[model samples]
Target: MAPFPYLAWVAASTVLVPFASRSETAKLARADVPRSRAREKLGFATGQRDATQPLVWFHAASVGESLSVLALITRIGAALPDTQFLITSGTATSADLIARRMPPRCQHQFAPLDAPGPLRRFLKHWCPDAAIFVESELWPQMLRRTHASGARMALVNARLSTDSVKRWQQMPATARYMLDVFDLILTQNDAMAETIVSLGAPPARVARGINLKSMADPLPVDHAALAEAQTALRNRPVWIASSTHQGEEQSVLKAHQRLLRRWPDLCLILAPRHPARGQEVADLITEAGMSHSRRSAGDAPAGQVFLADTLGELGTWYALSDIVFLGGSLRPIGGHNPFEVAHSGATVLSGTHVTNFAETFSGMEELGAARFVSDAADLAEKVEALFSDTQGREMACAAALEFAQQQTDKLDEIAARLITTLELSA
Candidate 1:
């Protein structure tokens, strides 16, 4: 019933224009979009789009967002028998992660390209009864097409950045269009709730919901690998520079250099968060002239920076370290999940850009379970100081781990809300 902003988004989906010139044979040889399209094609359910069984769709943007929804999916699958799930995401990495974790009744699909044609094909075929988008995935076509199909929509774990709010406020026409799509918006914190209201979503439609990460169980690690890392780290002090961004790696290198001076055998484990960027980080380490080893490349040389360059091994890296610096915060990505660092017994240090994870970080800090650094230099200083005194490091981690353990209950509570809210509609 409201004016929509579907034209610009519709025009932008010319993503397939280049494919028009290439031969199908050539496309297949290059593993091109058509080849990727085949993968997308198989996930479609044409004739049965509106079959008797209820279809609930969950969409997330990437690996982090997809993983966050896992706990909620597991609960939904268990409680609702005969209910099928159609999960969609925009990125390849998100789809891959979901592939590994798909439940019995759930299916993973490439979200229909945001263009009008493909999105129409997608909604016309899938016709999901309820759409659940995680953490602010406000695609106009997906929301409008599905809603127009008479399906209900809700944004679980919704978030809106302050800058994004101000930006959207300037485009009230567009903001109002997308805001109306999310009938219920469960935000992660008060700051996020305020941002949502500013973005034209009414106060009544939004509420602060518990963060999924605080409710996340750490990814399990292989015992053998865990033991090997533990043995290599035996009696030697170690700390993690986790999910570190591009510029932050050089800072960690200098910090490792600084801390190594005090605790001579100190080994710094650098997890760049993006394993694909291992080479870039490796180059930074080399430019800084610190010898390093890639986790993907057999064992890291002793005294060399351990490039924990593999996905799914972050837990192992966190577990083996005594101190943890969850990255993304040092230079304003607002830090990675501190709750994860807290789950493992490690002294957690993050940067001040924690507006995103304010509640989780706040609880950890209140419990004396975590600390913050105002700058990279301060992060370096804190990492060095924590490693210098074993007693202080242990105290910090003990408090953090205990606090993290207390958060397991939040998952069930939030999952319950998702159930009640989604099942309430037509």
Candidate 2:
């Protein structure tokens, strides 16, 4: 029997799911999400599943979570040639990106809502042999129904905050019941492993695993675009502030102002985390009195500031410079992935609030591949030091590249572990 809280949740969701699904579908459609894909959340699948071949279902919450597992899925597919994969994520952004870069034999879909009707139709159609839930996506009904269907399940790259741990600890029976659905729970580090265990996951089932984000395939670089940008810059010293959030852009613009004093022709490629804010960010650059060009407008990197307000071109921007400042850390939004920057052969500079990728940043810092900046002044200072010291900058880039390379070597090991734990092998 399930706990009272779980039972109550099921009862309420059963009554409210229809109305909720309609409301959500309308909201997503208004956001320009295609009506066809939005309806998938209401238990409609866009494709057929092959019942003869074993299928592995991976559910991730958003873009980062979905992309992190692509390499692992490739490795697993190589080992089990007869296996097909189904990846489900909740966001349209993730859906579009995954469609472009999906691994062979894999299909992407919008995850069904965690209600009886959606789950029933989803499970009945897909009939996944094994399910892998990534990070903190512990949808109660999804887990319960999948487990009840006799499909082996594992939670990979698991992480939880102190507050979440406290909340789970307060409902110990519910926590245990939910966690027991997983045959294995692989956490990002030892601390996360301990945290999950404390939440009632079987100690034997919990193990420390590498951060999957570290193993993401390098972002695809458009060679023609890279060449054109490099030629336009004509040897100007460049640094990029990639994935900048709202509050962080002001500091980045200030730092760019400071850099202009020493290196008059230095170009700053500012890519915001959300490109929809291009006009807003352009206003900030203008207020800072910097001549700027917008990438979405097809303007070249001709100004002191280049606003890269486009999607899927981060690789080309990273290739423009060796000094990269990753944002999202300046505020409490956690941090963007540094491995992507490192993989592009650049030195990483970030702020101090990177709780999401704490272990990842610690490793890079230890390798002398990444540095932490406090404010605009500190950011300018660090960027200046890297620009002036050629040897030091090269060493940092080399160290970062080395660190990025080391992560892929662990993918096969992780893939094998998942295979054994989930019994996904033919």
Candidate 3:
């Protein structure tokens, strides 16, 4: 195999590691260690080796991708009682979430940096029997070195955006070299399967599967917290704008303003996509003349908006609201997961730009499980209508829940393929 470009990548990454180790994101990822103690922070050493048992390693990009792999891991692990699973992710948030959510016989670790030296230490120690990469987190050196170690590799839930395809087309050999490393390539849809093959993945190796996120159970909720929030907002009409981006918050606040005119005691729950931006979102609520309380500050909703500025608690917010508008769709940030809302048995709503989840949203729209809004004005209208019409809210919630339920058979299909590939008879 012509792996020269990957060799070049390893060499270049060696020089970049120093800078990467010091970045704010990296600091968080590496557990807030100082740059002077870089080696300890970056997960260069894999602490222990267990070579006797078959080990399957799965790498996911971030929190979303990491959570998506849970059902697949659970199914496979149950079938292959002798096998163990290791999940590695780059972000601290993903690691924290995985710690709580990973199934029995599954372990979580911070992924080693893709630089050759750390990659070598990581691969040599883990000595995984198989490697599964999720979504689009294909690091060249990581791929080349792991494949060279004789591990069977597969890329599952693969997606190549239009921009990614264009870039891969410019460098065909490099693309093929990376794609060829995978024994199997499972795309999120038929179109993505076609796109990957066109970008040089062998046609025989590529097949389409449902987006794994569709199978994820509703994000876990703290029942006590849910009960507390329920008690706090007793008999109040509540709506949520979840995972809201910067520009979209204004739209949400504006929609809340409109909704308040009709339902004067209307409670708006605003959760930003990033917890770090909680203060900013709080500031926006202030500027919009809305009274609010911040979740991170141990305050309950004293006014119009309840700022859910905490991480990994979306499940609580989803449970508390019947009318849910998923954020990131209002602007061009594509969208966040709509399945999570549906799985929570809430009526899902979104704005026009939902290309990130286009197929899923289209199917929901067809089922009358979700509503699409054109802008802030449209969002307000939809929210107001859902709140006023009790029968409409109940019907929409039931449809959304049914739509989520119907996708599980697709998850069973994916589990069957994984079982076959892993030689786990079930």
Candidate 4:
């Protein structure tokens, strides 16, 4: 790894992190309500660890990465009787979700802020035997501190988007130093492996692993809630515009407006990529001159655009939708997990930015089991087309189910490798 830029970038990030921590403290007061107890929100009980224990640490960024870690942790614990894992994430939402799902022996925490002092304090206290980082969480201080504590590190199920690679290239030295810190860089596909090597992850350490993201169990949704939602909107042709970013919603709303003129009873559910933006979405709907109601608000009318401003229920929306237009792509954020929506047996529509989940969506498209919309208008057209063609819709759904059946093996392969690498069976 080269020097100057890498040093500066780390120095700058090290400086900025404290400010970022301040912002987290600020956000907690505004939303989480109990501002003072934010640090205790890490999810682990407050106290020193018992001296006699085997410990490994896993760090993830947010809900998606953390949930994937949970899948791996389950495998680790069933095999290793003595090992206890320390899991950490950055957000309260992630902390709460992990509070619900982490393994019996594992503990979750807010992963103290990524500055030298806090990370050093955390490393000294935890003294993990091995450290694992889930996709895209390349915090320098955490990596450096973990390595210094004599814990070997691995970047598992790694990914590099085309855009990210370009940015990293401009600061080759910093990218390389960060890349080299990992003892191994396991990728989900050859392209990612190639990109990792190009970014200076040791070529020998880079290998293809199953994308843990691809392996997630279709999220569990509440059957009672599904039945209730179905009853609430009886026989309406429902489609979801999921994980919608900013500009995409306007197009989706326009398309929704157009579709209503024809289908008249068409129901649309817009689940924004960020729940905090729910009010903004409601405003956008009102701006479009459409009646709307938020799930957060009361008395949802049958004829309004429903803003599903909640977390984790996205699966339920997909399960209920006749079609799903995955949001990020139609605008520009490169797309989200179309596989999740596809697994729900909903016809899937995506825009071009699926660089993140490249291989997964490609397989779905290869099966002719999902559609790639040119944009929001294309999403509307495809949904309208599928609605008029029940036979075609059923065919796509069946193929999607078949495509999903093939992914079960991939999950097992990843979980097995993670268990072996962590030496959990000992």
Candidate 5:
């Protein structure tokens, strides 16, 4: 609103975008985009569109954010049967996931680079009637351009971490300018709503919304792969340390080594957060004198460790194991979503530093759905007990499943509010 102060940043980014696009093209063979997609990300399908139809655009930062919006998108699509939807995300992985799951009348594209030139091209081509941004993807150029074009905009499931709030607080003018662009702001929690209002979002337009990430469908599974992994393991006690970061994998492997003493036939499925680091994790397994197989190399569980390093098959591994220790928590990485693992029917385990989903984990703990471990030794102890205690594991699994299912009512409430905000029922 106050003459968005990002012109200089946009000007510089516009000049450098071409070189950045080339660098990104080189990472096309890689799973996640390197430094997010640049100019090349503006490409969208030339699908036929009725000129009379209203088009709503949804932009999400990456795979998790993209998937979180699917249920909301589906509900909105069902209500506005004549409207078309364009879903844009910043990563190739999100694009791939959206491609497989996007409902009818919806399409996926890599989000435009948040530079003036690319943003203008993207706005001109799509000329979206309304925009909904998921999570914290606050690209100044994109938001300003969309607002200037007179499109209705909303920020849904808005979450601003303490770190992000501190960063925004340092640039009050810029933060206010960005916050004022949204016609509506639905935050992930009341605290987030308060933060948004404090940062200059109109208080009348901001309110607490349930975390849509919790409403995401369980990650999709390849049934054949799941069955194969299940048969290969032959009913042996299996557990997964999913979405592990660099240093976190070492801890997981060490825990597996310790657990092996008590359960010789135990299977540890290690899934790194970044699949590109598959080789690095495999080397760690080798150095520890453990036989391992790499999933990216098309290897199965012919050894003690099954390296689930391939992209987009977490559902299979979640299905293959009853006990799952979510990894990013072990290090200070803020942890990955354990609810998703729970949705896939696994009892969840996490490390102590789960700041990312502290509230969610706290609720789960109260419900007896998840366990916390302080270190590798604690992790090994808890994992072994879960494997041995069938009753305890089953009860946790049931509680987690119940918690995931309860998220739908929240989705329904958000969908109703979104319809009102977008004036879709008009």
Candidate 6:
């Protein structure tokens, strides 16, 4: 018999499925996402699965989570040539990006809504031999149905916060019921492994693993575009404030202003976290009285500040500078990934609030590959010091590069573990 809490959730979700489907379809349409893709959320699986071959399904919640597993999938595919892959994510953005970077023998799908009908139809079509859920994607119905189908299951790179652990403690039976679906639970660190075991995951099945995001392929770079932007900059000293958030840009702009005092020709590339806010960020730049050019407007990096308000071009910007200030840390938003920056041969300067990547940042700081800044003044001061000290900057960059390179072997170990644990060898 199902636990009372699980049964209650099932009843409520079944009743709400229709309304939820309609609401999601309407929202996706409003966002200009294709109707075909939106219908996927309602359990309309597209494309035919190859039944003769083993299919491994991977589910991730959004962009970062979705991208983090590509390299792993590729490695597994190389080892098991007959294994096909199905990757599902819940956002249009993730779908679009995955489509561009999908590994061979892999198909991308929008994950079905976590209700009976959608999961039923989705499972019937795909019939994946094994399923892996990335990070914190814990859909109860999805797990229950997938497990009942007899597919081996694993939860990779699992992590949870203090609040989530407490919440799960309150519903011990429900937590155990859902988590028991996984044959293995590989956590991001020892702490998370402890947390999951405490939350009722079988201690024998839980183990520590590296953060998958840290091992994802470096962001794709466009060399032609990089060349064009470099020509436009005319050899000016360059720095980037990439992935800045809403309240964080004011500080970045002020820091840029301070930077200009020492190096008048220094170029600042301001890439916001959301490119949809291009015009809004442009307004901020204009109001700040800095000369700026907009990337979406087809403007080159000619102005003192270049508003890099587009998608998937971060690698190009990173290629142009060795100094990078990754945002989201300045105001407690939990810092963005510094691994990508480090992989691009840049030394990282970030704010102190990097809880999301606390382990990664701490390791980098200890190795002298990254630094933490308090605010605009501190950010400016650090940037100036790096700019003046060529040897120091190069040493930091080398350390960061080494840190990134060290993860390659770890990824191989992780891939081997997943293949063996999931019995995915073809």
Q: Tell me how far candidate 3 lies from the true structure as C-alpha RMSD in angstroms.
A: 2.4
User: Backbone collision count in every prediction?
Assistant: 0, 0, 0, 3, 0, 0
Top lDDT hit: 2
* Consecutive 10-residue window with the lowest summed lDDT within model 2: 22-31
TM-score of each: 0.84, 0.97, 0.93, 0.85, 0.91, 0.98
Tens digits of per-residue lDDT, candidate 5, 321-391, equal 77899988977887778778778877888988777677778878888889999888999999988878899
Model 1 spans with C-alpha error above 4 angstroms = 1-4, 7-52, 101-104, 162-167, 170-174, 375-377, 424-426
Q: List model 4 lDDT by residue over 321-371, tens digit each.
A: 758888788755768877677678776788888877778889999997877
Candidate 1 residue-wise lDDT, 232-315, digit = tens: 767677778888887788777877777666777777888897888988998888998777767888784255578888777777
Among residues 3 or more apart in sequence or in different chains, the pairs in candidate 6 whose N, CA or C atoms overlap within 3 Å are none
Best by TM-score: 6
Q: Give the TM-score of candidate 6.
A: 0.98
Q: Model 4 Cα RMSD, Å?
A: 3.5
Per-residue accuracy of model 2 over 1-59 as CA lDDT, tens digit each: 99998999899999998898888788778779888878889789888999899999999
The C-alpha RMSD of each candidate to the native structure, in angstroms, is: 4.0, 1.4, 2.4, 3.5, 2.8, 1.2
Output the TM-score of candidate 4.
Answer: 0.85
The residue-by-residue lDDT of candidate 3 on 1-426, one tens digit each, is: 565776777788899987775673466735663343345335554345466678888999888899999888887787678888889887777878888887878887778788877788788778888899999988887898898999888899898778888988888899998998888899888888988998889898899877887678668899988888888888788899999888899988988898889888889989899989998888899999999988999876557999999988899888888889998898888887888899999989898888778888988989888999988899999988887789988999999999998987788778778667645443
Root mean square deviation (Cα) for candidate 1: 4.0
RMSD of candidate 5 to the truth, in angstroms, is 2.8
Looking at model 6, residue 54 earns an lDDT score of 96
Candidate with better TM-score, 4 vs 5: 5
Ranking by TM-score: 6, 2, 3, 5, 4, 1
Error of 5 at 107 (Å): 1.3
